[model samples]
Target: MSVTTKTDGAGDSALVFEQRIQDLCHDELFEQGTGSEVAYDLISNELLLDGSARLNLATFVTTWMPPPAGALMAKTADKNM
Candidate 1:
């Protein structure tokens, strides 16, 4: 495979988006690794069908809260995990 690079609008090399070996990812990992951008885009697209947590009333865990508490939790997420 060949990769050619050009500067993007942000002046960063656009070669990563030129990935040519990508395949659909599902229960198994791709035999050829897709670049991070493609992987993230696919995963996020898959998650688009999922319902928003705040709209799920049956969940036992807290879903709706003030912004400050959510921010605090987000800040300390690594420690909490």
Candidate 2:
């Protein structure tokens, strides 16, 4: 998922906030780990202030998974043989 920010119209503050979120998502500790639940909880509790607003961070993490096309096919082939 790509997050686009309108830097010119929103001003520097918005740009910085967006950048921080992007950085957090791309952090090494988060990248090489399976902590979607943890990440989701953290974001929901800390960043999402509005009680009515709901965000699903798990969906974001799943976007980064390796495609199952060829991998699953190969596994099935092995099982059949």
Candidate 3:
């Protein structure tokens, strides 16, 4: 998603949050694996423990990203069979 924010404007908080979340998703923790419920649960717990902002970030990613990624991976695996 595209996020735009002015440096000294009111939306700065949202912009920062989005940037932080984007960074988190690109971190090593998320890079190690995908599609494992154990991994998802662990990540979810970690974010939820981090307070509301991080929790929201985790929720956003989980809701928006995982399903499509899972579907694509499944399709690829099926094609390879």
Candidate 4:
């Protein structure tokens, strides 16, 4: 039986099921580009597998931040240190 993991998006090509096609290259750098949308989609889908962030009840202070700080973070997300 063929087992499939990915539910939607991506297209007919398989990432989890297919052993031949490499979803990502490990050692070697890509000689060609797959465009911004394709690269973003691949990363975004990978992050989805990690699930949403959850606050620990015992360390609520560490996880919960003021709305102002959160807004600031969101606004400055693109900035480099």
Between candidates 2 and 4, name the one with more favorable TM-score: 4
Residues 1-81, model 3: lDDT tens digits: 559632333333444435433324543454343334444544776766655643444435554556778798568753433
Give the C-alpha miss distance for residue 68 in model 3, angstroms. 42
Minimal lDDT window, size 10, model 3: 5-14
lDDT of 1 by residue, 1-81 (tens): 559553222412244345553456458764545456655666676677566655655445776889998898789755543
Please report, in order, the local distance difference test score of every candidate based on alpha carbons.
0.57, 0.46, 0.49, 0.57
Q: In angstroms, how far off is 63's CA in candidate 4?
A: 17
Task: Name the candidate, 3 or 4, with the larger TM-score value.
Answer: 4
lDDT of 4 by residue, 33-70 (tens): 55555566667778777534353333345577899988
Residues 1-81, model 2: lDDT tens digits: 659633333233333335444435543454343244545555666644542212534324544446675577467754433
In model 4, pairs of residues that clash are none
> Which candidate order results from sorting by TM-score in descending order?
4, 1, 3, 2
TM-score of each: 0.33, 0.21, 0.22, 0.36
Error of 2 at 13 (Å): 31
lDDT comparison, 2 vs 4, better candidate: 4
Q: Which candidate, 2 or 3, has the higher lDDT?
A: 3
Give residue 27's error in model 2 in angstroms. Answer: 7.0
**Weakest lDDT window of 10 consecutive positions for candidate 1:** 7-16
- Decoy 1 TM-score against native: 0.33
